[model samples]
Target chain A: MPQQRVVRTIIIADQQGLHLRQAVECAQAAGRYQSQIILVSGERRAENCRSPFEILQLGAGYGAAVTIEATGPDAEQAVEEIAAILSRQTSH
Target chain B: MEIKRGVAVSPGVAIGPAWVLDTEEVRIGERFIATGTYPEEIERFDRAVQAAANEARQIQKTVSERLGEQYGAIFGAHAALIEDPNLRQEVAAQIRDHSFTAEYALSRVIRRRAKILAGLNDRILADRQSDLFDIEKRLLRQLVGQRQAQLQKLSEAAILLAHDLAPSETAQLDRQHVLAFATEAGGRTSHTAIVANALGIPAVVGLGPFLTDVSGGDLVIVDGNRGLLILDPDAETLERYRQAQAAQAGHERELIELRDLPAITRDGVRILLLGNIEFPEEAAQILERGADGVGLYRTEFLYLGRKEDPTEQEHFQAYLKVLRQLPGKPIVIRTLDIGADKFRSAVEPPAQERNPFLGVRSLRLCLHNKSLFRVQLRAILRASAFGDVRIMFPMVSTLAELREAKLLLHDVMDELNEEQVPFNPQIPVGTMIEVPSAALIADLLAKEVNFFSIGTNDLIQYVLAADRTNENVAYLYNASDPAVLRLIEQVVRAAERHGIPVNVCGEMGAEPMYAFVLIGLGLRQLSTPPSAIPELKRLIRSITVEEARRAAQAALQMESAQDITNYLRDQIRRILPEALAV
Candidate 1:
């Protein structure tokens, strides 16, 4: 049986917005593992935050609180990495 | 032996002795009957294949350690293929009976594998040029070790005329000696083509089959603008090309001298000829070339060079460096222009993207990534306090988007106020009228944004529904097309109604011939490359806006886009008869 992990992360910075670089980082880190990653906004569960194009497609604006859940090998690692990405609220 | 004829890619005339690069040859082993037992021959062949595999692995490691994992992976894959169990058995059978050298044996395998990867490299490279550079880097390492390779011994300032250049080899090219580049294997949209364009070096590719016949030093001339390659030209043709080159040199000297002169017309009509630049260092070069100010500073590169979002401080320093150089000149900075097509990050990347250029890029990407966009806005606004600076948004197609973007700009201002950072409160924010919706409703969008700069690159592409790279439709991608012309007119008229200044910043503005027409069409402020200033100044000093307006009206009345393009191209041909054909 695989361990499950859930992390609540609030997008703090509203000004710069969650950009392509951040989304790319999130997607790239998550894509490396075989974890089933899902970004949940209230009742909506956004599938696989590992693709920047998909993240942009979601139209997830700034200051939005989204829950991240990961399950599989390296699930805890993926959730923590994505949470850290959101905490910064910006990418270079 | 001495050779003088070759396309001038980098543009320093050199007369150097012939140095031929190693010509990759196709090898086929001749079958010879086995003198000994078959199993013994098979064993010997297996050992030879293993040796080749070991050699490949070492090369892969060296490449990976020197370059990166991405480059190393390419050779590693090739090594795997070379050592594949099936291939080893097949090639081993041929070599033992035929008694061929390792070079011949390797070529035989490569020829069969070529059919699979055949043209996929170019297709993949067209979508992402950086990927092709990865391949080119690996090939350069492989070539360096080859015994017969002749490029190692080349003397200074020579023109490199090859069949085609892999990305690694292109990266390794010594600009000091390579005057120009021409190849038989690359198209206008190929990796080599973009590199040539960026370097501003003259190059022509895709002159297929001609690569096989030319020696190392055959007098070759590359006309990049027209995609023409002349080989073995007689004395008369050489003299004509040399004269053309000389005149271009003279023209450049004239621009340098004009650097100190004010960019004014004969009637003393003061026009602002600003430089559209990328790097902050390039801004210095632009000023040195006599630009009035920095008209278009592409902010995308700040985000592009690094894997992370640039810190507000990082962005400020880069902007300040340029501002310090030109204290009085206005710097119009466009926000980050990245999307699926031009991203520089490593993770959850814009993967397996399709049509990134037309899809989520520029302003659309900005909206999706608000946090990233806000930081840039704050920095640009902060930088404005140091000198005259204006912020512009690219690919703005909607009034709603413009409204939202402005509000975001305001939000940044609020943060700066809280942080007690000093910045200009009245800094003007502008939107580019590159899309049809923005141009059509320019009056409305112009109200929200401070000004409009007509980005004809995107404007022409969208209006004509033609990708400039697409060979089938590239002929249709004309800015002079009546549809595009009408859009430009609409945007300019709308800007006038609101008293907002409108400018042009496309390749069209850079050409001296098109400068006349753009001026006549009512674009008073023009931003182009620094090198184009003197010629444009000379052109402006010669023609009145009235003559240009007359030409524009006739151009719009032409039936087909090609007709209009031809008419405009010909009109400019007469104005500056020796300008590049494009």
Candidate 2:
């Protein structure tokens, strides 16, 4: 069977954008799934969802739209979790 | 004689060599390397990255352990940014592609990243540029084989002038050499300011771009008392500051001498000098400075920086710590003075009020949250058995509110009695005379409480209809205002009639000059910061109560606040010239 792929466009709603702590949270949440997750915004793409540095390099600040893409058996769950983390307007 | 004004955090004056701390940037020009030396450049960059990572980790660990996990996490963020695979790859690619020096390559790559973060147009995102800059500098220092200027190890005494010092940097400040500090950024309650205060270093912050106007080794005067930084003063000004500095030293010596002496005025009027403290640990400083006891131990600090409401055991432990610290000394523990600026995350106040100052806060909030209030009261009562402890309720406006608070205290006492916990049954209860309503009805209010502590900071601001924190209306918020003095006068008279001891425990009482007026107003007990005790005690001992009484009478008759202020200043200068000098 072809690898299942899930993609979702989500707006970064946190006031601090994809800063270190938030990036770490996203990375931790993404690590729980078996799927490979990637975040993309404009010309920038962070394929290493578990790398906070890569997430920060995306520069996806407040109001910036980013695409969360996942490919695996649990692709749908991975994309939903990562997308929810990015979309939530909270620090904790 | 250029004077830059900032917010005064710690009070004192310092005239010394200026030490400009421009750590944000290191002037490093691009240097070309031979094409064959690309391998060497990459190796150097790799080493620097490793060293920087190690340093970041150490900083994170030490800071987290010392301060808190939240604060220590910043260094972890820095380490993560530094160890970014993309950043390392970009620098290495630059070193190979252009035969550029490692420092230059790293600088360029980091600068580009910072630019990208800045261009995001989000304020919080834009701040990340500083993180980028900090990491870049850390790497560059490691690569260049140079240690970052150690602020903790200054060669000589100097006034530290910086845009700002982080809490970590401020914590490591050499108390012996850095006579004082002035920064371009920070508020009175910022971590740096708080550390500065705790370390007893006079500091002024919020002077914009002070580093730009000052050079290292130039004569600078940091008037922390007035929040003024004078750069390269004229000879006359230098002479003036020198005398002031000398006077400060002399005044300190004089006050230290009087530390073992009682704070009694001439003609045998004994005044009690107490320390207003937040943390129990500060009780030592209070005792060191010769404070008779803790006048006000704000219990609100226990509520801060925690998600969960402090348990009864936690509150009991905290009160126990303060009580044990000052064994037999009187310690007035104000119960949960939260709301109207002081708040805890544990207690969710209703959606932001249109007027929070007048909204449900302080005693009102406590009344609503009976469970929380009861826990605090139980702790206070339990701790009172250990030492001389007094329970004070803050922001009590009405007789009904006071009665309600007392009724709840009675309930807590009954609960403790049923539990068979040993507590001081007669733990002298008091109410802070801060509200205008409380002050106006002091005669009736005085009948209920054991003593009265005039919280003049709020009383003056409230009575004048001005928010002291609001810069625009700050001019109207003067304790010397005739109206404020009259209200204070009313409370003092009421307390006198009831034969209840009244103390002034506010910013007004902290001022040696203003304290003299309070003395004249029949406030025999003054509670201020531990740092101000010596100076206040000296002023008390220098003047007679009769003299302060005359000044108070004249001040009350004055029409304007400015007139009253000027009159008091002149009177203080005449009676205690050394008091004005310090």
Candidate 3:
């Protein structure tokens, strides 16, 4: 096997849903490592933590669970980091 | 490699891969639904439509993970708009009755009723942001479609290249990856440039339509310091940027040489040199550039771009953050100087006037609305306990107005004390010497205030009756004009007679060319952006009091403003060519 990365689910339970501040925190955390971060929800998937709008395109509303996958030297770290961001309430 | 050029919005240079943040891809998804399709098609359309919206939200969440909540919020807001009852019903009705897919149904309603969705109270309707949506709604329908054009996400620590970007889209940028930005479309003071300055990102904007010449990920060199853009860099171009960067670094290294050096003249007169900052992060630069303190912390930014008024606690926390960073530095916070050209969502809707530039605004508005001023005053008074805090009011036209503002500050301070809030009771309050009436009666106004900071930007505009934005009157916006200098000289003398200190925090002060002239005019304090500190420090060190005083005395004899400008230009051109060139 070449390489494998684990994908886990994250629920956007916050009413504000996945907003920009969380995106920034998540991206910064993911950026700390050398990993390819990816987010998959339903049949659609994208680069997990990219720009704020890209994350919103997944349209994972309240009560929706999102799959987050990271692969690279620091895959596990990236997943943990993004998960933490998605867990917080919107800081408005 | 590709190359382009534009107006330099901010300064600094860094090279990296390209990360273009575009919002076009966050549009309605596609679905194939016939007008006369089977009954089952309508249900499928509804399901697809819901899924598309769901997909958009998930994408927003994922990107927010990468970028931040700002981008997440924008999409979140859009997501909410779609979920609005009227809109949801309209889209659902269109899907069922017109037999259209959900994405198609939503897009139709959005396109046809863009005005309704983008009214002053509309979900898409925002003051500064409305204009961007107006442009994007049109462009999104034409150039972009869901899943057609790919939105790029570059590795961290990369420069951004783009033809153009909306202000909100630009601001939501993760500045870490985006080192420098060069745009195809923008003006000198475009929103993109404004946000770039706020983000402290080195940006070159307003390159016109020429950005189309460059494509994706071409090796680009944005010399924002010189407003030059080089593409397909040859060895010489690369070496030039490297050398220029090294020399710039050397210049900064020399600036650090002034870290502990006092801003003193040959005559041994010492002056406080401070920096004007717009954001909290800029506090770091204030220290790095060796500013004695912050002369003018424009709190207008706190009210700008924000959807709601900043709570007193929020403002206190921000002020505390900056004050803690620069413990002993005097931070003169100019309270919410919005008006004349700025507006915030929290502000009352401005009545359409014949001439807004001369309309009732700034201090006039704040005085009229006591609650607005009180919230800010409470925040300031609360934060004062932490550091050397001072308050300066803008657009004060009379002594009574100064008294009124001071009274409001007292009320806020009393409340803070009663509420057991710790604050600096003896905090000095000042008024901007901008209104001509205030300058003419400087003696009376100075009596009511603790200090004065001449807002030369507006002072010149009001005194000369010259709108700086008007091209024809721009010629009158000269900072070195005799009329303006004379007013400043008068104000300085009045402040001296009253035993109060006066400082200049306008662009005129920031301009290194007038560093000596202002000091010679009895100004012991000059607050400018830190970028100009190195050059200003050079001018301050180079001149003797004897020379500056004589020049000021001679220049005062000139009658016309142009004569004063020409005189200062020639005088500085003769000496301190480096500062002038910079």
Candidate 4:
């Protein structure tokens, strides 16, 4: 069977953008799923959603559009969880 | 013996052995490893990463338990980064593919990542570049087998000497064993200085590069009062410092004896002494110092040093903390007084103001961001229900701004009323007369507010057009200047005419000489630091209002700020000869 793929685009709404703390949170959430997650912002693509450095290098500042794509058995759950973490408006 | 000068941030003297903190830079011996040794290098890298992760977790546990969960969370984040599978993979790949040494591979990967972060346009993200470097140092320490100079595990009391201290290291400082600290780099407003002040530890910063001149276990004297770091003091100098230390203690004891006494003049005029505190935890110290109440509860701390603007609930909790601590006492909650630059995360991209002091700051920033202003007002109103909470707006240079702020407060009050929130609807509103325009038109402002609080620190700076922090022009920023005195007198006269009480809630009120002038200029209330209340009360108790008024009248007639300052000093010296010793 072909691997299931899930994709969703969300705007970074956090006041401080997708900062280190938020990046850490997103990576932690992505690490839980057995799926390959990719975060695309503008022309840059973070190949490893589980890597905070890759996610941070995306430079997904406030209001920047980010597309989360996942491919695996739990692709849908991975994308949703990663999107939820990135779209949080408050730091806490 | 060598003497070095720096900026004195926290007061008091500390004499102890020096504990030199090593810089974070790690030396990597070899950059590359032989192809045959690549596998061994990878194993070493893995072990180092594990050790660094363990260290981070250990710090997190100790800091979380000692400081708070929030501070502990910083280390937890560090641990997560240290144990990052991606970071480990990159380091291992560097070692295997390039045949790089473990130390070199870790440094190369971390530095590249840090450079990426540093190059980012976002300041908040760019600031985290240091954290990456910190992690690199931690891992490198493990790989190099270098023992960390653990400040938290100091066995004996010592004066910490360092080129600079990281925020994490400063937070983990064991106050019992860390007597005081002096650094070769830092300013008055640095995080290290603020932490030292909060911990009541003597600290001097920005002493230039003198770490090489001294070694660990060298006896040192940190004269925080004079911003001097005396390394290997001579016997004569040491004896003088010992006497000074004893004198300081004796002086404090003498002031503590006057805590219960009212700030009443010899001629029977009672003066209200209050405290200016930044944190809610300081409310108890104000009461202990025998202050009447809190005159200026600076609310900016809630908005500063945080990732986001404090929620309305957070603001309410902070105000409620102070209120619960000082029941029935008047607490003046000054609204947000920070510049727009500070809220760059919440607001638009920073425009890099050439002069932030004159830019959209304080009340102006609040007016531009009404939602932010309303959140604070709502919180203040909510907390007003608990105690005698009076709202004060800072940097109101114009009548329109004051009217607009008051209008917003009314709107917030109405909203609270609709929501059936119990609050003091009749809560007093006041304006900080710091701007020269506010002082010039004090009568107009007095009519709009329940009271007036003369903030002489900014008033002197504005009137003289001098930056107090700039050493070159700091002399011009004198409270004893006739221009400043005239403004205070005008504001006082205006408040008197309008039948409103005036309070001086600036550093000017803390000094005996200045307090004499302020009291003579007809200010019945003075708010100063909690530590200053007893001394100010002592000064108040030593002189008569008649004498103070006469001295003030003479000082106002003087020509230069220097002349007026000398005149006031002479008057104060005669009134309280013991004040000179302090």
Candidate 5:
């Protein structure tokens, strides 16, 4: 069996963008996966998906594109979950 | 003796040992560790991180259960950040590679990361740096074994000296042991100041850069009335404060003796002396002080220092508490009167406004956020069924704003009816005559509302165009300014014309000189802090309404605020010499 890597780019759909609470949601979603995940925005990249601090440092604003990259056995699942969090619009 | 001056938020005099709180600026002096102790340093760091993470989780659980999951999630995010594997890796690397102590290594890594977040273009994202700094503080406390001063567990009475106090910290303060407090930072309306006033604790705040000059257990004086913090006072200064404290005690006893008496002028004109309170608990104090009823029950405290907007139930519960405490008494529940900057946690982040006071606040904020307004209106309506609960809209500058607020109140009433919830449909609704425009058009506005509460604090600032908190222009913010006096007079006259009851509910109503002016201006009702009620009663009994009117007329004709102030002082001195002492 070979190691697999998955990458997906998603636009921030929440009106407040990737704020602290949204970043928490992203980190919590990434924490459930076994694969290592990273979020990339512009020139900056957050290597640790489980750290909300790093994810927030990505400074992804509303409608800004963010790239999620994952590797390991559950790389595809990790990418899907993280992308859903980034693309989902939260009313509150 | 060293003296520092700041804004006096609460009134009194206290002499006690200082309990200086350890601020967030924890200096890590020992930067390097022995080469052989790298493993031990890493273990120490790991233990601190574990403890900090556990504390964050505990707070999250408690806060989530109390406030809501939204607020709890804030602490949850902090816990995740505390246990961040990337952060741990960097700290361990610093210790292993550079022989750095855990405290120094952690601070360096956290500061570097926080700086990055702070430098980001996104304002909201940049604000997260505060969370990072908070985490750093928690970690440092654990690593250094320097626990935060347990304000709740103090054994001896002391005056607290701190750089700043979060609302949560101030909420947990054990009032019995805290005789008074002086802070290096805060304004008149800060949570600490409000709590101090509520607790009747002497407090002076916004004394910049004094915490570094003082130490724990050093004798200090918190002269809240004078807004002065004196350190290691000389014998003469100490004797003076001691005598002043004694005089105040005697004066308070004298006032308390008059608590059962009515605030009727010598000419037989009865005046309504109501108490203005921030919390529901203060209702009892108002009754004890012999107030007629609550003139202004500020509802902003419930919304402050919390992560989420208070639920409809929370609002109802708070109003019900006050109503139950003051049964059959008029409780004027002023609808959410906070500026956006004050309650950032409750309100969604609006674009940063340069002038927040003049920006969307109070009734304007309520109108824009209808759900927030609806929830409060529903609560007030529901509470009205229990007792006399009057709803008053704050910062109603225009007739349309007042009408719109009334329309929403009606909407809430309709909803309550549809839901089959019991409430008083005809509950009295009023508007605060705070803005200058509202004061000018009081005649028109009086016809719309059941009553009018003159909020002099905002009215003075708005008319004078001075921010009282800004020291440079604070002198311009005067209640005795002829312009302010004339506007107050106009409002009273307009209210009289419409046969609507009007009262002064700001700080002006609490002061002897200003209260005299207000009485003379034809204000029959005055709402002040409960502690001030007894003294006001004494003043009311001393002078005739006729005399007050004459004094006020003289004041209105004066050219300068200083002249009017001096004239009123002289008049008050002649009538009641003791009132001038306050």
Candidate 6:
């Protein structure tokens, strides 16, 4: 089968934006699947989604739209997970 | 004195010279280097980053355990940032192409990253600028060969003034030299605040850049009782504080005078006041404060500040030190209570714990690692030969854990016997009634142990399913909660039925309001930090058993913790207002 890819743009809803906890949750969740997960904020793209440092370095703050892209067997699931984390109102 | 206000985390009065601990700023100016030095510079940068990452990991473990997992994750991000391939590549490329010094290149990259985040035009992204700053500071500190300021090496006893203290740094503070601490940043529930309270020092945090206003070695008074920091007092202010200090000293003198006397209530009921100590050096303070014995000698300190587990000899020597200090006084040596808020890298690798409070720690960790348990047991047994030592297993949730621990103790005793080494064969064995299950089954557990010491700190948390460290659920972590009281009552009643002496060794016993409730619950023995002994003894002496029992009963009947707290506070206020500073 040809490699599947899924991409979705989600606005960061967390009031504190993509801080350590949210970034950690995203990275930790991304680690669950065998997919190449990448987050794009305007021109800056973070391919190392497993590292909270890289995701947070993107500096996608509150209400900032960031694109989540995943390519692999679990591409769709990875996109869903990243989007879910972005849409979550509270990090705690 | 020029006074400033902040949140009072720990209560006391401390007047001393201010030892200002300012964070060192590393200004990395651009320096062009030779072409041949690029590899060496890059290598140097890598080593610094590696060292920084290791430091961050260690800090992360401590912060995670002390604060919460989420708070700990900040350090995780820091470590990641330090080891970020993108960051490393940028600095390496800058050094290779621009011929810049490693520090210069790294600084430039970090500044650009921080600037990007700051310019994000969103609150969340903007706040991350601080995180970048933290990473830069850590890396630079590593590169500059500058160690984190050592609070352990003060020449004289002084009130510490710092911008903010990391939990690890706070843990390193020598209570002898650092009389008190006033931080320019930190909330009431900050790590510094918790550690200050644990160290029994007066502390004021959130003073907002008070460091800039005061010079090092200047006279400063930290009135933690009122959350005030006074700088360079006038004669009248100095006189006032001196008098207050003298009066406080005089009060302590009075309490010390009663040291030789028994802690007897007005009704002629004698109460046993023991000291909860973590180190052998605290024996002097405990004895000076008039404690009957060491109730809880938290042996976890042996496992901290080292890369390797303490040897059998090391453990014995440490126990012997404390044992020798107190010849006649019963020293209840709790065997390695490592878990929850307390962790040792030397004992085991860090596990990703969802809820460490409920995880395998304390006696559970001991049972799992029998050899480690046996070594401590052997040490405790050997130390018992020199002094009145009792071996207590902490965090015993079930009879099985209690049995497993005892069985290991027996094995150690057998091993000692085989080696023909002398040990106290009849050293009293006990288990802490901290876990709610253990509290619920206290009657059953009473059959196995020689005595009971209620660790109310964990008992309250376990009973309420609330993490005491967490600020969000802090309200539910109250010891005055009727549910928590009921559990304490249960443990007390169980001990009573079994004819075993029950003592409270948690912070609850130290607090006046909760102390009243604990006394009323029939806990005649109370162990607390040595600093609290004087005030607590005075409180105990003022109130009769009947009054305490009545107050406890009233507290038990109250539905809400707030109501119970109010009822007890009112009772305490009506009875012995002087015992309580607030």
Q: Please tell me which predicted candidate would have the highest TM-score against the true structure.
A: 4
| Rank order (by TM-score, best first) | 4, 2, 5, 3, 6, 1
Candidate 4, TM-score vs. the true structure?
A: 0.71
Report the C-alpha lDDT of model 2 over B1-582, residue by residue, as the tens digit. Answer: 798999898988898898888756577788999879898878888888889989888887876555545556677767777777678888899999998888888889887887876676655555555567778878888988888667777879998888877654775688889989998876664556766775678899878876777689999999889999999899998898899888778867888888989988987999999999887667788878999999999877677534378899999998888777888899999888766333433455333355767887788888988888888998999998899999899999999999999999998899889999999999999999999999999999999999999998889878999987669999999988899999998999999999999998898998877898888988989999998988887888789999899989989898999998888888888877756532
Give the better candidate number (1 or 4) by TM-score: 4
Q: Report the number of backbone clashes for model 2.
A: 1
Cα lDDT, model 6, residue B552: 84
lDDT of model 6 at position B79: 82
Give the candidate order by descending DockQ.
5, 4, 6, 2, 1, 3
- Report the Cα lDDT for candidate 2: 0.82
Q: TM-score of every model? A: 0.63, 0.70, 0.66, 0.71, 0.67, 0.64
Pick by lDDT: 3 or 6, better one: 6
Global lDDT of each model? 0.66, 0.82, 0.69, 0.84, 0.84, 0.80
Q: Rank the candidates by lDDT, best first.
A: 4, 5, 2, 6, 3, 1
Best by DockQ: 5
Write down the C-alpha DockQ for each prediction: 0.03, 0.18, 0.02, 0.21, 0.25, 0.19
Steric clash pairs (candidate 4) = none
Candidate 4 has a DockQ of 0.21
Q: lDDT by residue for model 4 over B472-515, one digit each (tens)?
A: 99988888888889889999999999999999999989988899
Poorest 10 consecutive residues of model 5 chain B by lDDT?
B343-352
In candidate 1, what are the lDDT values of residues B349-430, reduced to their tens digit? 4433446566888998888778878878888988988999999999888888888888888888998999999899999888
Show the lowest summed lDDT stretch of 10 residues, model 1 chain A: A51-60
> If both were scored by DockQ, which would come out higher, candidate 2 or candidate 5?
5
Fraction of true interface contacts that also occur in model 5: 0.57
TM-score of the A chain in candidate 1: the value is 0.77
lDDT of 6 by residue, B1-582 (tens): 578999899998888898988666567787888978899989999999999999988878876665434445567766876777778888999999999988888889988887776676655465455566667878888888898655677879999898776555665678889889988767764445665786678999888877878999899999999999999888898889889989988877887777777788999998889999876667787778878889999887677533367898999898888777778999998888876233434455545355656787888887877777777888888888898999888899888878888888898889899999998899999889888889999999999999998898888887788876568988889877888889889889999999999888998888887887888989899999988887788888888999899878877888998888788888888888666534
Interface RMSD of 1: 13.9
lDDT of 4: 0.84
Residue B260 miss distance in model 4 (angstroms): 3.0
Candidate 3 lDDT by residue in tens digits, B33-125:
676663564455445445544544764586455444344445444443333334445656777686666556656765555443234241212
